[model samples]
Target: MTATQDSVSSLQTSVPPALSLGVVALSVADLGRSLDYYRQVIGLEVLEQDTHRVVLGAGGEPLLDLHGQPGAATSVAAHTGLYHLAILLPGRADLGRFAAHLIREQLPVQGASDHHVSEAIYLEDPDGHGIEVYADRSPESWAWQGGQVKMDTRAADIGSIVASAGQDTAWRGVPAGTVMGHVHLKVADLAASRAFYEELLGLDVVADFSAHGALFVSQGGYHHHFGLNVWQSRGGQPAQVGEARLLSASVFLPEAELAALRARLLEAGHPLPATGDTFTVTDPSGNLLRFGRKV
Candidate 1:
């Protein structure tokens, strides 16, 4: 069972409410090429663009911001950086359409899995940045055991899902209700990562894959909002600024939740680096997470 099904009452008391993920920023080598890939392959509209940077999203909302650098190199090894940026679709029909589009275009799809809580399709961008397009299952259907959400990676029945599309609705673009669901990152150490995300930041450990060198945590227990893994980046350095790597990710919380987080950080001896309406913190793996309220 997932946390949403089993721990609603307890989560309401222990975790902060109204937490949501936001825009993920990246550094890219070629702005034009990355823009074309995101627009054509991923079906995202360019919300804003310039010579060096572009913000791409659906329905006028910004989800990904790509900043271009002339000599940037793409490297996954020797760096603790992004594992994947997950884009959550509004419904299964949307995922079906996307799956059909990928087949029609003969695009390279890496993998697809049923995660109990969500069904996800995995692929990569031109720069080899990982991407996951997924649709969550109903909260009531999710199961939980003990205090952890139950999640498993099984082969997705792509054929059946495509057939469910009904052949009426076509793939247009990312739907209006689409959102930046969660981000999975490769980190240096699981112990340190847990200290920052779970202990100091007060997120609930919804899934523990520590046996596989991974951990998934969330607030309010809908499943994981952030996934930390040490698969490829164990004991690696932080990603260089000029590389095509994850730059930052944002999380939205209410004012009271933010204040509570601040107090917790102070109590845990973590610094609060202020930036306008947001308070930014660097995780143990050096990934930047900015926490703020919705404006």
Candidate 2:
């Protein structure tokens, strides 16, 4: 076995199966414009709003929080930061309805792909933050071999997805069950990221694409909660202060697990500022993450 595989097998702690992602916060160039795009194009409803910030989601659940910084620098492709924030639909029909909505609205889609385990459609916000809308096949349908779940990128069957919409093709909004599925990041170094997320944070390495400069980690046999890659950001710097970029992504875990993770972070010299019921830390590649007890 490769040394990396050995390291993955040796991980001692696994996060609880109930671990889940919460709201993803972003810094955007214009609050109003970003708000409109998210609501109209992405189909999220505003949960709360003010002059400088807006919280949006579906069916009363807050999924995204946008903070506006007037004249903020636009995010560029070379930065080591958010590659995309994935939103998972609860069913294939929901994905089909969303796909049809994009076509009906004439929105520019970045790409669509079938990753064996899920089918996804990609888009970019007004400020260039990447977004992914997807739906998974049943977990039992996934194929695993040699301790790794097999996944790949290929052309999505858009026609079939749209056909799945059946007679109810009208786009209302994202359904109640939509959620923040996973976050993909462009890191400066794969090995360093692996050490931070896999070894230090205690996420299990579900798939390691070291040859392609990418890695996937998760808990409880899910495909991935985090996708780390160096594709465009190899040796790149963090997003500058004014750049429209990911501000923070929140992870929810059991209180006991959170305490254990805090201990791990403290032992590794990562700072944990005092925060009630939650704490924030910066990863090795400068990504901000907030941890909280799952309620």
Candidate 3:
């Protein structure tokens, strides 16, 4: 096989073309603290907020919803729950601006990596929720082999990325094109998580890092729309109801695809609890997913 064909050979490269990830809802113990962190540190503007709930976004898009739970405890480590929510900037320069802002503000960064397809910086919220800010390289340059997209974790060139921020680079806030790109979750088992997201939800396993106990799935040949990892929560129970953690992740689909997904869930014996025009279901590891049409 030629070099390009060889790279594509081992990939499970089929994904439904009509799905897009939407807002992720989180439950937090102190709404005010979490709200401030996202606004000042993460550079999101508040779109809507009330005593109990706050919606934050950039350029009029809603990316996160925070619900206030006055006395809720922190999410336990031994739980099938969130690993992180990745915020995708439109370009590498935007990532540089954000990184420079973080450094100037003296915010703590957990780590960073060059995932081959993208560069990402990691941090934790006041509630211990993981957050990843990243920018994708051109798809033409992505590497693929062994039935999966190539991914590796190495120290990101932080100095170089930060240096990209010139006076022209403004850190007003998340730019208009910023988006909640993908979500990573801790799952009890990789096999079951793969079946749930791939067979049931129709995502393609673009990358599988079994050696690292993680898998990435996506649609339309993007690097990943969701990441499932067993690093921290292997063999863990799902978060209990009323826990201060991830609540539900929303996905928008065309009407036809929405109906087709409903049928698949029914055939799999999973309940589709509907409310108005939206329906929700719990995944194999108990994370809630909400699906609706893009009307």
Root-mean-square deviation per candidate:
2.1, 3.7, 2.2
Task: Assess every candidate by TM-score.
Answer: 0.94, 0.95, 0.93
Candidate 1 residue-wise lDDT, 26-141, digit = tens: 99889999998898888899998889999998878889999998778886665998999999999898999999988888988899999999999999988879999999998787
Give the TM-score (vs. native) of candidate 1. 0.94
Runs with alpha carbons beyond 4 Å of true place in candidate 3: 1-15, 273-276
- Model 2: how far is 112 from its true place, Å? 0.7
Off by over 4 Å in 1: 1-4, 12-14, 273-275
lDDT of 2 by residue, 160-251 (tens): 99999899988889999899999999999999999899888888788899899999999877889999999999999999888999999999
Residue-level error in angstroms, candidate 1, position 92: 0.2
Number of the top lDDT candidate: 2
Residue 44 lDDT in candidate 2: 97
lDDT score for candidate 1 against the true structure: 0.86
At residue 184, candidate 3 shows an lDDT of 96
The alpha-carbon deviation from the true structure for residue 66 of candidate 2, after best TM-score superposition, in angstroms, is 0.3
